[model samples]
Target chain A: MAAHRKRTKGTVVVDTVGIVGLGLIGGSLARRLAQRGIRVVAWNHRPHPYAQAEADGIFCKSTLAELMTAEPDVLVLCNPLKAMPAILAELKPLLDEHPATTLTDVGSVKGMVRNQVKAAGLADKYVGAHPMAGNELSGWQAADPGLYDDALWAVTVDEPTDYRRFFAVASLITEGVGNRIIVLDDETHDKAAAMISHMPHVVSTALINELTANPDRNVAAALAAGCWRDMTRVALTDPDRTRAMVEEDALNVEVLLRRMASRLTDMADQLHAEQDQGSIVRGGSLKGDAAAHIRKFFAAGDPFRRYKAQTSSAGDFPARELEIPEAGWQQTLLFSARRGEAITSFIHPHQAVIQIRPAI
Target chain B: MAAHRKRTKGTVVVDTVGIVGLGLIGGSLARRLAQRGIRVVAWNHRPHPYAQAEADGIFCKSTLAELMTAEPDVLVLCNPLKAMPAILAELKPLLDEHPATTLTDVGSVKGMVRNQVKAAGLADKYVGAHPMAGNELSGWQAADPGLYDDALWAVTVDEPTDYRRFFAVASLITEGVGNRIIVLDDETHDKAAAMISHMPHVVSTALINELTANPDRNVAAALAAGCWRDMTRVALTDPDRTRAMVEEDALNVEVLLRRMASRLTDMADQLHAEQDQGSIVRGGSLKGDAAAHIRKFFAAGDPFRRYKAQTSSAGDFPARELEIPEAGWQQTLLFSARRGEAITSFIHPHQAVIQIRPAI
Candidate 1:
């Protein structure tokens, strides 16, 4: 294994970082980095947030070209996904001129962004990252550095991904932003994201839509309590944003949605069987096969339940060192993530201090 | 319209309430009533909470017979659904002797409880009620009077239900507990509850079941944020409790589950079609019929979104009085609830001050 120390203790490989957008994510990242005394240079599509951002110690640039003049060690594309192609096109020549600046993004979908980067011929310098942070609120006005507190990030990599480039983003999340890192391939990241977020958004939307269609919608709405409110909260957010996220990971979201539908249908069939069984299934108890199936359905998620309980009650999870092999470092880290281990810090370029988290 | 005065202004028909089962729901109701200067008598299957309940000014009884001695104006069965039959059987002779007491309950499912009450030959004294209150936590220790603060209750009545009995339970909610009331029949209450709470619980459980079955579950769990947390929160509660609730309201929950499954399946189909349409559905935007269907699906819940926005932003909702025709008063109040009106107070026996809420 080739062990190369990229930076000193308590510091990241990235010094000056260029942020391509000053939206919620980018603005938060810029503010966080500046608060941590790291040099942050950022440019937004509009100049609205520049004053406040500059006052927060971020060097706000008026143009992407101006942002590149800082010659940052890392450039994070935090602009809207719709602006990716145009921004990537503009940044390609500038990135070529400043060859040392590794390209990364805070996009929710990784594989799509990587493909776009490849199309722009900047794949050689690219790494994909998505921070598991944010709130119902958005835009520059809502951006706060605390949004990333104790956040975990999925740093996506591939066979062609440069180790140095991956390390730059990973170290930025780990040391600079003071967050945890879980290494995964782009497909794994997107599929897992769809399972957790994108697919659930569709399900939440379906719930409100169903309620809206019901003849007794007002009665149901009045009866709604914490369960209904919590379950459908995400559906009330901007549908256009959710639609965009789902479509970006359309294939994965579609697959997961079908799987969810199947799960619901199976439960419905079991319940219907219990209903048809009549007196044999008396007093809130099911009969025969339906009983067993219903029990199994509820019991299936026990592992996740236990995991949540453990993590919520846990404080300062114990950490251990994992040696990264250069020949297959990416797989090694991905395997570690599968075991519910998050990289808290890199002791050196080849050794990561991983913390064990409760897993399903 | 027949007008009869039941109580003077600022006074409820119930001066004392007898609560069976001093658990979460019962304990909270007892505490709230006691705090409001109303006499509260309670009995539990266990005597563990007797001391603390008595300390809170509640008259704790060791047996159901002793509880009936209070001669409460309203007798509320706050025990679990499974215990309903046994509790009702024990109280049958007692309730017969204390015929002046109006019977009600805090069960989540109204029809089932009403059926049990009817089977126990106590239908003449029973008025079904389900409070839109509670949290994930349970038991007497977790119970607090604040749980009833600004809560709305569904008071169920049948064609044969006595108006005075319904008024006793209704006034207990409005005046004694300082909560709002919505009158409904057993079927409407059960159906509306299934739509909002029970069906959503199953969907939430199905979500966790799907996640737990996935190979990349830990990856997805690691990437999970607020959406996953909120959507699956109810599933993390006692599975047996959820199973019991679904089974008790089997027919309604079963119907809603199937509808939800169909909605998810439809969305999945549209997403698949968009995928098949190739470059025509470029950059997070759909094309053709699939596009139109997807747009419609997302837009279908707009009314609910608007209603939520309006309600959350508005304060001190304007209220107006509605005359209650005694001949068909039950139907009149049910219609009021369907129109999103909650009874804040009964100005007279035949009139209700209903507060208008945003309707879906």
Candidate 2:
């Protein structure tokens, strides 16, 4: 252990960091760590980014063996998912040589990786992490010191794993990199990822394929409205990176796609049945409850969407100075439905904690 | 027609305009027409927006027959799809009684509407129109006089239909309402709408459905991250309006979904076979060309998306000031290497039309 090694977050200290596969996440971590006066020795497959990183004053190593010899306190694996196992195997020797050096991976998928590391009896030294961050852009050029800020990083661990080891790795990444730490089992993480990241990526990529699948590719492209741009933002990532992420969790995505297919089929059937009954037409269309089923189907998710918009819609929240004015003076009560269901009120001259529900 | 009627949009002219269905589109149109000093009479199924429109100083009529009695030069139907036909039927005797009145609809799906008008022998007085405009919100409060600005208003008509009549309607919308006119036939318009508007809506709704389908709705919502919000923006429309629009084109959306389903199935199969071969590991993963198929699938529409971004992305253009003074001293020079093509060189005191094809 180096004398410069100071506790960064809850029981986690690292003076020398070894960053492998220095692309966006690795490079970003390196940049932030170096800024915080921690030593980062790096290696990237491509020699150009390696040169750039070296020029930026990082100690660039040519090989993983050489990087391990730098006596790092921790190693961060930022390699593509498919390449992680081999990288981990290469790292096995270093772990044997330096038993104190711990490890973690930033791959999106974790179940198989956790299993592999667990089988290797290295679960004591490892925790699987995925920071839900990054723009559509990737690679070293896209790396930012603030990349992981305000993002949720899932710290996945199996049962019977070393909780202390998990906390050490998780705290370093979450507190050091400024991500909110969420503890989830590997399988739970994968299911959630399938819904949020992997499934959406599938839909986006499939959407592009569907539009271009027709000979009307150019015509369809002409009709690419506002919605298409935002929806396909995820599909614009580095091809190799996308493939690696999607490939690691293909089966789960397949199940998700099948489920989505069944839903679409059901909606289509409902629609066809209504149309066959000639209810999509004018005369008695309103009187008939044809659109009721479809509307109900859509309205189920309305609250969730509204809740997200009220809280998560981008932009600065409206700020202004409000006057409470002399405490004893009477003032009209004001409250938003969004603020709370009820408010604490004091009656006439008696200061009682009375909860008053808003009439609105 | 009132003698105060002036020629608008080169041919189309109106003094009094009846804006039926005073929702976002109708209210916005009324606002714009009133601003142009035209007499704007309005009718809505609801009383609130009608009162609001009247308060906003547009002549608010109570019934369709009352709106007809006002003897407007043109009638704009801004009702939802299912309601449009009934509204149009209500305007029928008026159409016959006042032979000079022209009618146009702003409903999304146009084929059935156009056919119905043609079958009713009102094609000469009618042209189907849909403005590719609107924010996420609907209704009078969301209406803006600038709603149709920069949006394409598709003017759809059938064969043996009045080309002059179509232009009269198209020009009124494009020039009067400030929408860019795109003259597409009813079928072409429907197909384009299916690809652009209808299918995307279905997919948005379906995506939210898929994510929230399980008991893990909250979990799915928490993991919603980034892509979920943008991808599901369109699914947040008024449920009834969404149902009407989607149901009108459900068969087409079903077809589109099936196409999407097939492509998704094919991609899943490819991923599965690649995984089953154990080639998803480091040894042969990249070497096995597993990701190549997936990458190719995503890359097909990248150019189209990129091209659209380059053109449609609204922002200030890269501007630079060039000093071209004392024009007689003109020069033409050449730069070479455009990859296996010819090159031409010319430098002169007087510049002529110089064309150069460079070679590499």
Candidate 3:
């Protein structure tokens, strides 16, 4: 690709950009950049994705060497965490030969990769970036060309970084792919990611695990609706990645897990206390402190209430009748009111039933 | 409105059905029904939805009485929980004067309302039904029209219920609303709803409440994405109805809550114990036991994983990097593996440094 490019002083104008690993991010970038008149030279480790990319008219190279031989002004790394080190190691010598060229990587975690590059002593020439966008589907076929539009591209620069080369890469990313650039130090980035991204994943995975592990899950699954579906949607995420995330960020995840555990324990203790105090009456009513606690729990901006209302309002169904077979016929009475009408006295459980002759 | 058409037995074929409460379910149902050449007579408690419904060609009824006087062969109940009891009571006497009429309601919990109807001696005329479809949105304008298509409509029939009327209502709902009917007894229906529908709501609500109530919620919220959003989508549910559902089905909801509480506690203990044991070694690798447990939790068919993948794939940027501090370097390492990538044993906590290197 260097053969097709002309270098003037320190500035390299890249006509064709080569992208390795044509997955969701890579494919999307290629499609978008190619549409913007920049030729995209792409390579996928998997032959299927490579064929698919070639068929989509995305410039495809058969091998890493072939990709490098294309001599593009820039090389984009869009591989997995495991493959990133190997790919970087392989490209280091080639990059050394072409001192005029620049390179960037799109990975979710930067600290480790940065260390890897630094260990390999390729820090000045390599920049680490992450585009904050994506979906569940993977592979080049699922890649849309317009994926990076208006997205934040975080570009991390170290103390030894070449300012000219950093700006050159950042400008291309912002102009060709991203909306803006967020320059952060490595430590702040990891902590923020742990709090915002990693911790949430652990929490979500834990919740899903809780639901599936329930002994009464059969019944729970039966009543599962959009709420359950939405809530546990991430539970089906790839187990390996999830496992790796939890393993890698065990400290922050442990903190989150502790908080969740404390809250759950408190809730459980309250429930048990209510049970011990005989607060749960047979007629689906909570009495005394139990009632107050239940009310407080519900009143605390719980989203379940809104979901119930939406689910309830979807169709015209009568309120469910609680069957008290043990308690036989009593004097039952029914008093009906109109919507928006004035309310009279509240009907007590006893008043619900009244002995009376038919209205004549 | 009654003057427009005579109340002949077969003359009142409902070409246009008016829906009063056009929330998520109502709106979706209306849209679907309207697509089938039926005119939707819609009336909301609020007047703001009228213009939007009219723009969508859903003929808005100015008043409830006007809708009642219009005498459509079928009247659907899409109002709120407390409102249903009153509306049904008022409409009971009016319907007694009009022959050849049928009515249905869509309420989440059925036992309480069924008891009210049975006490009022209106069971022979009214058929209670619940359609298992909904989202976090409300109001007539929020209606999607196609919501009920292919969903299951639970039809509750008891001793006092008229089979002929039940079948008629079921047929109309199945053909018109686009959902199949699942016949269930009132007791089974309530229990099933409690386990499946009500319990999920409580779990989701608890999660949201837990997240919101966190002292570090600002951090949690920033880190929140597809997993957190999907898990708490139900948190947008109507508060009042949620309060009632919890109160009325306190027994079942409590049971599920207890289960969730225990599960969460166990996970917390596991994570905490691992931390205490220093199971996360120098390389940031989780011990065999902890890793196995984490893997099992993730592989347990939770939907969160799937949702994460979808969210990660949908937007422009599939992969982005956040630099964590050296202190929190483990967080990035754990979550480094993206979806669709295999797990490899290359993470080195000691080698991991929080440095911003130049882009590749």
DockQ winner among the candidates? 1
Q: Write the per-residue lDDT of candidate 3 for residues A1-360, one digit (tens) a residue.
A: 232122112232456678988889988888888776677898888767766666666778778777777787778888876676677778888878877667778876667668777766688777777776677788777899767654555566665666555655655664455344445445444554555566556655655665555443333343457765665555565656766655555565566656655554555556556767765434344567765765676567443334334433655322222221212211010011101011111122112111111110
Give stretches of model 1 more than 4 Å off.
A1-11, A279-286, B1-11, B280-285
DockQ of 1: 0.73
lDDT of 2 by residue, A83-195 (tens): 66677777787788987777888888888787667666677788777777777767898877788665656666665545445545654664455444445667666887887
TM-scores of chain A across candidates:
0.96, 0.77, 0.67
Q: Write the per-residue lDDT of candidate 2 for residues B127-238, one digit (tens) a residue.
A: 7777767777778888888876656565666555554455456456634564444445666667667776777777788887776565445445545577787788778766
Compare candidates 1 and 3 on DockQ and give the better one.
Answer: 1
- For model 3, state the Cα shift of residue A131 in Å: 1.5
User: What is the C-alpha lDDT profile of model 1 across B1-360, one tens digit per residue?
Assistant: 113133336546788889998888899989989988999999999999999999999999999899889899998888888878888898999989988999899999988888888899999999999999998888999889999988999999999988888888888888778889999999999999999999999999999998899999999999999999999999999998898888888889888888988998899888888778763323445568887888888889999999999999999888889999979998999999999999988886788888998887
DockQ of 3: 0.13
Ordered from best to worst DockQ, the candidate numbers read 1, 2, 3
TM-score, per-candidate, Cα-based: 0.96, 0.77, 0.60
Candidates ranked by TM-score? 1, 2, 3
- Over A95-160, each residue of candidate 1 has an lDDT whose tens digit, in order, gives 999999999999999988988989999999999999999887789999899999989999999998
Of the true interface contacts, each candidate retains a share of 0.85, 0.37, 0.32
Candidate 2 differs from the real structure by a C-alpha RMSD in angstroms, to one decimal, of 13.2
- Write down the worst ten-residue block by lDDT for model 3 chain B: B338-347
**Distance from true location, Cα of A313 in model 3, Å:** 27
